[model samples]
Structures are given as C-alpha cells and as structure tokens.
Target: MNPCFFYLLPSLLLIGFAFQSFGEAYETKPLACVLVEEIGGGGSSIPRTIRQTPVELHLIDPLNLIPEAPITSSPETLHLHVTDPSGKLLSPRLSSCEVTYLLPQEVPLAWVRSLTEEKRSPRALGHPWYSLSVKDDASGNTVSAVLGPQGEEDDKLTVFLAVYSTSATLYARLGDPLYVPCGFWRGQQFRSAIEWRHRALGDGKVLYAYDGRLDRIEEIFPGYEMNFSTLQSQGNASLLVDKVAVSDHGTFLCTIYLPYIRAQRDMQLEVTALPTVTFLPNPLFARPNEEITLSCEASHFHPLEISVELLRRLPGDSQFSVLPGVSLSTHTLNKDGTFSLTASLSIIASPEHHGARYFCRVRHISVPEGVTRSNTLHVAGVAGLSLEDGMYLFAVALALYGSLTFLHRKFKLVIGIHESKKDE
Candidate 1:
C-alpha cells in the first residue's frame, strides 16, 4: 500500500466536509440578512441567512455612493448592528442576526462587560446605513428596518455597530510635482477648458490657469512665474511655477465646470529641496607624520538652513559617527553670488590615527542637490612588537628538556622491571 494514500485521504475528507457545510448554510430559503459596504469608489455585498430555519437579506442603494468619487462612504469595519424589533438571545446561539458592513475600526462590541456605563455608546460610525432583519425564537418576535437617520434606528436596543477605516491617506513629498493629464473628454475634438485658482493665500496668487490667460507678475513684491502644459485627449490640465515659495504656497483649487458633471480638487502644494553637503576627500595620501588638508563647499538658502558636520563611518558598515569637533577646525568662507561656506581637514594624525578617516559636512541645505564626500588616510609604521623570534627560541628549549626527562624515566622503569624479575 502506498503511504501517500493516508495523507491524501484526510485532506480530501476535510475539503469535502467544508464544502458540504458551506452549501448547507446558503441552501435554505430567505437569507438571514445582507451586508453592504460602500467604500473606495465601490460596494461589496454579502448575502447571509439568520435563523434556525431560513431568512432573507436585502440590499438597498438609495444613497448611490457606489460610483466614482464616493462621499461619506461606509467605513471598513466589523459593526454589531441591530434592526428594529431586535431579537433576544439564548446561550451559545443568537435569537436572530444580520450580516452587516462596517470599517474594521468601527466595530461596536457589546460582548465586553463594560456596557453598563454606556460603553460603546458613541459607536464610531460616520453614518448609519447598515440595517437588517432579526427573529427572536424565545419570544417569537421578528425585526426589520429601513435605511433612515444616522443613529440607532428606534433606539432602545443596544448592540455593537461595525467600525471601519473608510478613507486612505495620500502621501506626497514637498516640492514634488503631479500631473492631471488631458484625456478628460466631453465628446468632440474641441478641448474643454479647466481653471486653476488659489484662495486664502493673500489674493492674486494663481499658480496656474487654463485657456492661456495668466498675466506674469514681474513688478509685484517678490514676483511670481507660471507656465501651463496641455493635457492629453482627456481634457485634463497641467501647470508649473518656480520656487513655490511660502508666501504663494497654500490650497490650490482646480475647477472644470461641465454642462453636466463639474469636477474640482483642492490640492495642497509643498516645496522641498535637496540638502547641500560642504565637505571633501583629503587629496594628499598622507604617510605617517605627514600633513594634509581635506575640505568641501556649500551655500545657504531661504526658508531652510543647512548643518555641517564631519563623519567617520565604521568599517564593514554604512553608519557614521560625527567627528567630535568637525566644524571647529580652521576654514574659509565667502559668498560671491550665493551663500557659500567651506571647511578644511588637517592631515597630521597621531599613531592612534592608523586607520582614522577625516572629512567635513554641510547639512540640511535645500539646494535641490544632495552631496557628500570622505577622505581615507592610512598611517604607515611598525605599530607592534614581533612575537615570531621569541616564541621560536622558547619552544625549542622546552622540546629538548621534555625529551631528556622522558628518556630518563623510561630507562629507570626498564631497569626496575628487570631487577624485580630476577628477584622473583
């Protein structure tokens, strides 16, 4: 008999049992209840039956938050939802229940012993859309509900409502750019116009505009610049401006009002630049006791400043420790057109500096360029005593003394054995 047969039989048996159980649960008439979730520009529906017999579940879409750009959607969660005429329960089994949709974060748990103090009262539901049917076998009572106001339907019945994380956070880097391509169609070849406007940022600060009607602001205090990029066939829009300074940074509104659907967005803009490093590699290959200098350069920027420090990275790793007084050394400074600062690296390292590396730093400068460098200086010398000759002499002397002692012991033992045999 094949040993593999034993493993195959158990697996097949389990799969068959699961399928049989699942089919039985859904085979009966009216489903227990239906759960519907309106989230992430879509809806997920679950059909369930709640009864000793069979019950039906219904899904309602009166709000119509199912299409693109949903508003106040159902949070993703496990909600303890109750319907009108909530069913009473029996130990280990529910009198009546319904499949409900909720953001996982909004799960209202009535199972906890803390419900006596109005626990789970402010059940975290942005809206009340989950409703269902329930039956109480002990009292022969039945409950049903219709989508109504956002709160417990016909209060008096206390239960847990499902919680959810309906909204996802969108992240973006400062000064980074995103494009809204033109493929936004309204039919024919004629392009539809989109306008970009900004408010609450001290008027007249339009980062971009469609229809090519932006007036340049050269004479204004700390002037502004704007440029527009045509979108693909989708009727979208694109725009760019230099600096994106704080005086002009804030919420930007893009409105494309159509004959039917109006589209708009309040995009937040942030400006970020690369850090400038003012350090260099020690050009001179310093043999022990030789002097050399290492250095780098950097410039200052508005709205953000840079920090400079020297780092000596540890061997076999990518981590570095800031040299005790990297910026304390002598250096030169000048600003021809831009803010410039240069530091130097002095070469004469002590015997303890055998593998010591020296460098400079210019940290946290927003220059749209990130730069860094280092210098390696090896101190050449006989740093330690040689053990080869001393160890060689001591080993030879020990070997000879051991051999002589062993020969004397062996001869004495042999002679004693002969003398003893003769006496016997």
Candidate 2:
C-alpha cells in the first residue's frame, strides 16, 4: 500500500465518524408535544399550540417532572409523554410538569396548587412571562407549566424598525432621482451595521452597508449612494438613488443591526418612461381639392393610458382648440412594451383653408399638456388661384371693356349727326 493512502484513510474515517455523531446529537427527539386550541378569553394562556422548550429531556429533574403516557383524553393540558423505542413507559410525576420561562429578566416562578386561590396574581409570575397550570384529574394536583427555556431571552436585545411612509411602494420616471426611506426606531448608539439589499435580485447584490463604529461604508454598486452623513446620526439609513433606470425596479430590503439583534423593512420601486412626441411627416402643403392627413405619434412610453387628440388654430385665432371630427387611433404595441398613438385630421383644401394652422395635442401622466403643430399648408389662394375661377374672372373683364367701347362710338355718331344738321 502507498504511504499517502494509509495517512488519508485514517483522516477519512475520523471525518465520517464526526459527521455521524453530530447528526445523531441534533436529531429531533421531541420529548413533550402539546395540542392547544383557542378557548378565546384573552386573559392569560397562549391561544395557539406552543411546544415544550427543546431542552434536553433527560436533563429535566425526575423528581420535579416525569414523562407520562400521551394524554389523549385531556386536550386542555400539555402532553409531555413520549413512548421509548423499546416500548417502555416512563411514568409522570404529579407534583410538577416540564416548563420553560421566556422572560427578559429572571423571575422565580411561584408554584400554585389550585385555581380556587383568588390571591394568585399572574403579575407575580413576571412582568412579561406568565404561567399556565393544569389539574391532574387522577390526583387532583395542579402543575405549573410554560414553554421554552427559562430566562433564555433575558440577555437578548430586540431591534425595532419604523418606515417613513405607510406604503412602501414608490413610483418614479426613468432618469429621475429617487429616494427610499428607512430608519431604526431604537438603539442608535448600539447600531453596529446597516445594509441595503435588492430582495428581488436574490440579495446577491448588496446596495450598501455601513459600519458606524468604524465609520466605513461599502457601496456595492458603483453609482448608488447612502445618506450616511446626516441619516446615520439620526438612526435613519435612507438611500438616495439617482438617475433610476428600468432595471432598478424591485423590492429593496433595509436592515438595521445592533449587536446580535437585527430588523428589516421592504420598499418597492417602480420605474416608468415618458414618450417622445413628433409629427410623422413635416412641412405639409396642399392644393385645391386635395385632402391633407396629419399623424401625431407618441413613442416609447409605458402605461398605455396616453391621450392623443388633433387640434387646429384657424386664421386669426390666438389659441388652438380640439378639432372636431378628428379621431385618435392607436397602433400595435412596440417591442419595448411602450405605446404609440396617432391622430389624423383630413382637410379638403379650399381657398379658405389657406394659412390655417393644425396641431397634434398629446397628454399623459408622464408629461404636462402640450401640442405639436404642423406647418401651415400653402393652399392655392388668390395669389395662386384655381384655373376655373381665373377663367371666369377673365370673361367678366372682357365683357365690361367691350360695353364701354360700344357706348363711346354711339355717342360719337349722335354728335356727328347734330353737327351736320347745324351746317345745313
């Protein structure tokens, strides 16, 4: 056998044994289980089911508490008895039951034998921790009971969180500044660490984390910033996100840490984009008897509730108004999940329509009220009149000239005849 193989074989055996022993030690051998129903009096007992503290079952004092058979008839009392693998029953003690005390401070439990003693105050048990007792039907003895470890939570500190807004959801347009607010309601001085993470992104990308005592900040994303200058002193750890983008939409978790305690709050971000509005064809012109069409397009806007309308400013009109009979039409959605709307206005060009101005008005939640106007169509007017009207005007002028010439000749003939009669 190789020398290296002999050395590695012993190490592998030790590793396997250690793992086997660890698994066996932590195996779920629940000593006591209870089925509790809500009796609904709100006074003392925990309403829902609470299990026995996972303390070592064998370590419990046999004189004070003993294992009994699983109690099926009595649902009011906690069932602490579990049958062994060998089918042997370890009898229960009537004087006491296994109990765990959960209190922020150490308070000695006062064991009572009966509920008829009106002098018993639950407050006497502890300020926050209370005791529940059940009577042994066979022995008529009362056993004081609780769940979890006694005084296990006395050294534990709690961290509380308070958000700045009732609704943690916020909406912002793309390329706009955004703020997500979070703060610690307690333990400012003991605040050891603070973190901001994108929960939707699986928390792999930590936005920011700050160490107060060391006064160091680690910004995971290059552009993201935390308001640690003023907010850190005030127990506020809000993030000021600039030029937010579509990829920034997600639930962000803010965590405040103090020693062994920590708390978190979630804030949701939604990013939307504004549309680009323009006329489809520019510098419009028309002739007499011609039809003119105008299309106003709003492109690349999210949330398809955009309003589009056609407007016209006639000659001598100061303001533009909604042009009647113009219908706004929408087309198929764009590939980027935005919307495009077009409003067309057709005009049968006449002499009266010359110099008339047209507008394409668009309104959306992303922008203020505005109109994009088209060029004034130079329709054929008096300067460039229609061929038929020009021919009619020419005919009327010719008749008037001929009538004037005829009247001059007739007056001359009458004057010549009068002069001849005078000569005779």
Candidate 3:
C-alpha cells in the first residue's frame, strides 16, 4: 500500500482537476442589470418585443434570472428569451426604457359597464395580440413577454356592446306619437339582434315597438307604420326618431343588448286634446254695487266649470286679485258648455275714491283655466260743495230781491200821488 500511494496520487489529482474544469464551465453567473421599464421596441425584428406586446413582458422586473450558461469572464453578446412566430432567432435595436410603444391596430373602446368603475381593458386592447421581449446589451439582462388578452380580458371585448336613445319627457296633443330609438353595436365578427317589450294601458298595449335594423325601413308594428331614419351621431348612441302620429303616447323604454353588454333609456309621453275657451262680452258700465256678470265658457269639456272675477284699477295698488274691488266667483257649466257668473259690486251714489275703475273678468266653464276681462268702468264722484259757497250765494240773492221790491213800490206811490193832485 505504501508503494502504490505515490503512483495513485497523480491519477487522483488529474481526475480532481478534470472535475473542477467541467464545473467551472457550467457554474452559475451573476447577470449585469440596468433598471428599465418594459416598453418601447416595436416594428422590431423580435416578434416578442416587450414594446409590441404587453403579455410577453416580465410580470415584474429587475427580477433575478437563472443564467442559461455561465457568464465566464465576460460575454461577447447578450442572450434573451423571445417567441418567434416563425420559430427563428430575431435581432433588432431596442429603444431606451423611457419611450412608449403605440398600439398596432385600432380598437373600439365602447362599453357601457366601464362608465362606472372605468374599465380600461377595452382601451388597452385598442389592437390585436402582439409579442414583446427586452434585451439590454450594456447590462447582460434580457426578458421576453406576451401581451394583449392572453385568455380573457372581460373588459376588452366590444362584440355585443349595447346602445340606446330616449326622447325628452313632455306632454303632446292627443293622437301624437312618442319618439324612442334603440340601438346596439355592430360587431366585427358577430351578428346582432333586437326585440320588443310593453305594458298594456288602454284597449291596446301602452308601449309601441318596431325593429329598425334593415337597409330599407321596415315596419314590424301590427297595425302601424313606425319609421326609422338617421339623426347624425350626436355624440351618443342616440338615433333620430321617425315622424310621430297618434296612438304612440305612453311611458316607453328602449333597451339594447349586445353580445356581452346591455343598456337602456326611458321616455314618458303625455297626450292631451285641443283646449277651447268662450267668454261673454264685457259689461258696458257698472257702478260699485251693480250686479256685473262675466261669462266665460269652454267647449269640449265633459262638465263645465267657470270662474268669474273683476279687475279693478284702484286709486293705488300693485298687482291684480279680485276681492273688494272685484273677485273670483264660481259657476258650474252645464253639459251644453254654457256657463255665466254674476258678480255684484255695491254701487255707491257717489264714491269718495277717485279713478276707481271696475271691470268684470270671465273664466270659461269646462276649462278651469281660462279667464277674460270686461271693459273698465269708472266710479262717479259727488259735487261735494262746502258751507262757505252756500253762504256767499245766499247773501247775493237777498240783496237783489230787496232792490227789485223797493223799486216797484216807489213807482206805484208816485203814480197815486199824481192822480190825487189832479182830483183836487
């Protein structure tokens, strides 16, 4: 054993040396890294450039990577991971980490649900799936990533986006139709559908519906013709309503359901009949206590109801209300649509109040709302002479009477004297 030790020592050392050499060749290496963002690098030869595809990039970065092989001394070139659609090596110049890459295609970002929490998946997917990978030659670091809806981005799809339109709420004359428009998105690869709904009100259903999805206008209504035209986009999914006719007034809603989205808008329609008012001629003249009648009649009302009032331009006042001057009086209108109201204002022989004008106003029966005014009448004033004027007039009259009597007597006496002398 002692003799074999010297001989075996060289062999053992040679085997050890060979093992260490092999280990050195396969040893793990520390990767050089420069912190960078995973964007910028499109139109790249690398089909999976991080700049082009988001899914292909590292979920988190500056993260450690196991060396594919030892970075012995220093590497002549950088090694990175990437998927080539053609399955070949790709070479390209990568941009600095600061720049951003634009989408490769135009994508529609229309979805209703997103209006709430604001889902931007639809906006991010403004293009188709692409690849991305990053390689920093200066720092021996490389990463490859995939981008865009890898499996399902529920928010990115617009296949069945819903749209709708509703008209302003308002009241319309009887036989006027309510306008409502329904719409949905036209998909890139799927067909769209639409239908109807309603709640019954009168003899017919309260709501009206028709399908307007055709090249030429088509009426799906049972006994009516509902038309469809365009009203320019108006910044929403709203479409113009076809002209309106009778039988379409009521509360109605337009609902649109797309492949994966649904939306709706509601409209209320009110219909009324033509309004009519009839009023009697105004009074010629009326004293304060005169019985003044103002007759206003409304036709087409089942039961007639009229309100009579007086308008007075008082000596001093601001606004108008019928009261002591003239006021509202009620009169029931007969089914014949004729109704009259007599209002009495006490007439004073002579009023102290000046320029007190009184006029009768008639609100027709049938319509509780119509009012008419009569011609204005003035309140007459009394002479109102003072005691001083009576005294002056009395004094003048006494003086004149005394003078006339005295003159007459004197004349008679003179005539008598003359006669007596003639007799002697």
lDDT of 1 at 365: 31
Query: What does candidate 2's lDDT look like per residue over 11-120, in tens digits?
Result: 99998887665444324333343332334546566464545432223222223323333324434443332212211112243223333333332112111111112443
lDDT score of residue 285 within candidate 2:
55
Could you tell me the TM-score of candidate 1?
A: 0.33
Q: Number of clashing residue pairs in every model?
A: 43, 0, 29
What does the lDDT read for residue 367 in candidate 3? 34
TM-score for candidate 2: 0.44
Model 1 sits at a Cα RMSD from the real structure of 27.7
Ranking by TM-score: 2, 3, 1
Candidate 1 error regions (>4 Å): 1-193, 198-204, 207-235, 240-251, 257-264, 275-278, 284-295, 300-307, 313-320, 326-348, 359-371, 378-424
Please provide, for model 3 over 315-335, each residue's C-alpha lDDT reduced to its tens digit, 9 standing for 90 to 100.
Answer: 476556564544334654544
Best by TM-score: 2
Collision pairs in model 2: none
Reference-based lDDT, residue 66, model 2: 34
